[model samples]
Target: MAKTVGDFILERVQGWGVNRLFGYPGDGIGGLVAALGRNDDLEFVQARHEESAAFMACAHAKFTGEVGVCAATSGPGAIHLLNGLYDAKLDHQPVVAIVGQQSRSALGGNYQQEVDLQTLFKDVAGDYVETCMAPSQARHLIDRAFRIAKSRRTVTCVIFPNDVQEAKAVEEAPHAHGTVHTSQAYSEATVLPQEVDLERAADVLNAGKKVGILIGAGALGAADEVTKVADLLGAGVAKALLGKAALPDDLPFVTGSIGLLGTEPSDWMMQHCDTLLMVGSRFPYSEFLPETGQARGVQIDLDPTMLSIRYPMEVALAGDSARTLKALIPRLKRKEDRSWRGEIEQRIARWWREEEERAMKDAKPVNPERVFWELSSRLPENAIITADSGSSANWFARALKIRPGMKASLSGTLATMCPGLPYAAAAKFAYPDRVPIAFVGDGAMQMLGVTDLITVSKYWRDWLDPRFVVCVLSNGDLNQVTWELRAMANSPKVPKTQDVPPMSFAHYAELLGLKGITVETPEQVGPAWDAALRADRPCLIDAHVDPDTPSLPPHISFSQAGSYAEALVKGDPDESGILTQTFKRVFS
Candidate 1:
């Protein structure tokens, strides 16, 4: 029996355990969509836009660690997927992108919706990108996409021409017993650094009087090993934003986050430590790291290129995080110093107090920090929170506490907006039993989040647990960009481009057959979340946050202060208003 190229492609992807797919149907991929409809095992989710579909795919991979798949039509539709594909590429998530192309007859003729996908997607799909020129190559191309995506943990693309989708000259079943290879790449295998490397890493760490730990997304499964190592070394742990949930925030010495969104304890601990143990993190901010010669370091990462890239290392261990840590543990020595750990605990306590004080500030509009703090207290222990890139990122990094069993992610590397809603929707889709929440800023919620809200509405019944929440931090501004402009560029205030019209996200949700509530006062923040969690359907909470409130960094620089002063003298309209709000916050 022979199969259409589309049939063979679908069979190959489904064989890889991809039951869910996100895509937008169009003339370019109509044959592929028809092939998809012929199968009952695969659920082809129709998204409002190709961009959201790509984001949903990336989020699916992030939450489940599976090869997320998405498809889009040629030209504009395929172009729309670039941003979301970059999200997966930068975060090192496995994703397979199936792109539609113009018919072979129309190739390079300036036909409608025709694009040279191979060239356009080269950067994102660095590992693999192939156009199925013949029906016989369909299975091989699809196999290569998923294989490369999973093994390399990056984006892979398969371009299917419109004519090829209908071509019938391929194997009927690519997953048949005789055709498949039983290789270890298709299964899990334990990986660890060499014994000598592990021993050297342990020795470097053990020799230091004061040690600190920095963890990232690569440390997700090695939480216990990381904690044990930190305990033995009496070291404080500072998590990269991508590793926020690697360890429970309640851990005595775990500093919440590092960089501009870092806690005071994290900044101090990393700088003061005599030695550092960096596991699975490529923390980009060198400023937050210890001065080059200030501390000796041991770096552990699966990618040899990533090891010791950020900081100079005394020892580099390249392998699986959990396996390497387990091997190194026996070689490690217990430190006698409780003073460093004690000081970290004290700083942690003080940071919490300061955060609480800020959270309780009585500004005319509700404080953004309060929203995260309230959500932190109210969120379920197993909730999966997805935050958008903006001021909300800072608030979540500093204020939200990730409890054990809970998972959270953001567009950490891409740092793009509009992924919050799509990410939450995908989280709910992947783990229906767990609560999924999206914490987004007003500007981001307006950008593409609102457009993707219908995705939640569309998939509400698919989940066994019907609870999904979108917490809109409605401050009517790109709060994060505004601060960056003021602090870094010496700008007066948020530019007109950064400001957005006020939106009632709650009303929008209500109109779409979901629960929606608008909370203006700080007092209403807690109840809004409570109501959202208890609601039977998807929900949105539009919390009116203070636009004048500044997302001040943990450490303020002299240059930033000077910029602020210069901006005020240049007559920013909001300067007096922000000053008054700050005064009220400090006093009240």
Candidate 2:
């Protein structure tokens, strides 16, 4: 008997070890979803929006080291999946998006919400293929989809036509979906750099000149090896934003992050180190980096694409960071760098203390920065935090003063939206006992199905219940980029005048069977926070923030700031007293 497309998909997913899929029920995939319903080994979770579903899938993929799956109908549903898919791609996550296409006959011309599905998605999916009339070949198609997702660590789209979804059956074994590995092949021999290159690198370290190592996310699992390399070579280490948790900042040789958002030690090392070893980092900040005349830079990456993509390197080797360091350990000669390491250490310590002081000193009504800082300080050593992209990314990155014990962090690519909630939820799912905070911005709140908040409240609740508190910085509008655009449109005429309608996200939470609290003043924030930490149910803290308050990032251009200056003076041509709120929010 020929197997139905539905049976083929189930067996294929089971074969690829995908037991859960983040998706929603709609007219497009009714047959497919129903078929999935009968499979006890697979789980189908319907999300509020396609973006949220995709995000959940991405997080699941990241945490489990497997290709996370999300499904959506064609047209609007498939469109929404792009944001998360883009995020997954940039973050190097394995994601598979199974989108239901309209009937084959209706695809070419606009019947209703028709789009050329294949053409629309080909560019987006790093790897993509469409199954036209091959219902019998569904198993192989799904298998190839999984292969693309894992090999490229990218989002792969598989468009399944609707008519053949519910045909027949196939006999399958349970073992197919039980074993899968997301880890790539890393040859040990690849670890041994050419003797000539190793000697050159070792000679520089042994020369007694100051050396520093900058690590990125690629070095996450190699912290111990990095430390071993540092110990033998007397090198100090700092990380990039993506690499913040790669090593314990408390280590005497470990400094903080680099970039404009980076700490003093990172900046100091870029300037002082005569020889720099960058492990698993593709830092594009050429301005902060020294010219070739001062310091020779070395980099080790598993992917060859990273080499010469941005800054030129004195040496670039494709190898496993941990194994490569281990191989180089014996070849490296130890050198004394007490003072060199001490200087960077002092700067890291000062930056840590200064950030704490800065957050503590800013006690005011609706200070979003202060909100982030306090949360970071109060979280336990092993707390896991997920930050949404947009204002939340900057606000949290700048304010959430992380100590060495932070266990996990997931960030969006530069300025996207809709990841914070699911990433937080997934982290909570991964480690139920740890306090997971979803630091979100109001703009992206509705985009995530709030119903998931109920899922969180039901299974994971408080200190004893494994808390998942969503702290939404509420400004009622997504002003992340538009504020700057408005400022840049024209020169100052006097402050412009505009006001967004008021919104109460807290009330929305109350309806979801979860504790909801809103704080507009600094005085009430402390207690609100305490209640959330201690609450026996999942909670949401709607923090009414000043829209004008500059996020202390993007370092708003002088032109934009001046333009904003005039916009405030005008004060909507209606509301006059609100000028103080705008100026203090942005300029201050």
In the range 1-588, model 2's lDDT, one tens digit per residue, is 355676667767777777778887666666578777667878676676787788888888765677889989867888888887777877777888888777776766776757677877776685765654445456555776787777667788887767657555433323455433232222224445677776666666677478888888778778888998887766778777667767865677776666655556677787788887888777777756666668876778877788655556677777778877776677777676577777777777776676665554433347676787677547766777777766676656555655555654555344466678887776665556777788787767765636566556544533355556899888755656545444665422222332334567678778877788999887777788889988777789999875555544323447766766666554533223235544444445
Give the winner by lDDT: 1
lDDT of each: 0.87, 0.69
Off by over 4 Å in 2: 1-3, 105-113, 169-199, 204-208, 401-407, 446-466, 475-500, 546-588
Please write out the lDDT profile of model 1 over residues 1-588, one tens digit for every residue.
Answer: 356777767878888999999999987887788888787889888888999999999999988889999999889999999999999999999999999999999998999888889999999998999998877677767877888888788999999998999888567336655453332237655667888877788778888988989999999989999999988999899999999989999888888899999989999998798898899898998888999999998998888888888999989888889988988889989989788889998999888888888888876678888989988888896999999999888888999989999889999898998898899888888888989989988888778888898877887887899999998988877888777877888887756777789778889999899899998888898988898899999889998888788777667789988887787888776787688876765456
Cα lDDT for residue 18, candidate 1: 93
TM per candidate comes to 0.96, 0.84
lDDT of prediction 2: 0.69
Candidate 1 Cα RMSD (Å)? 2.6
lDDT score of residue 36 within candidate 2: 78
Worst 10 residues of 2 by lDDT: 179-188
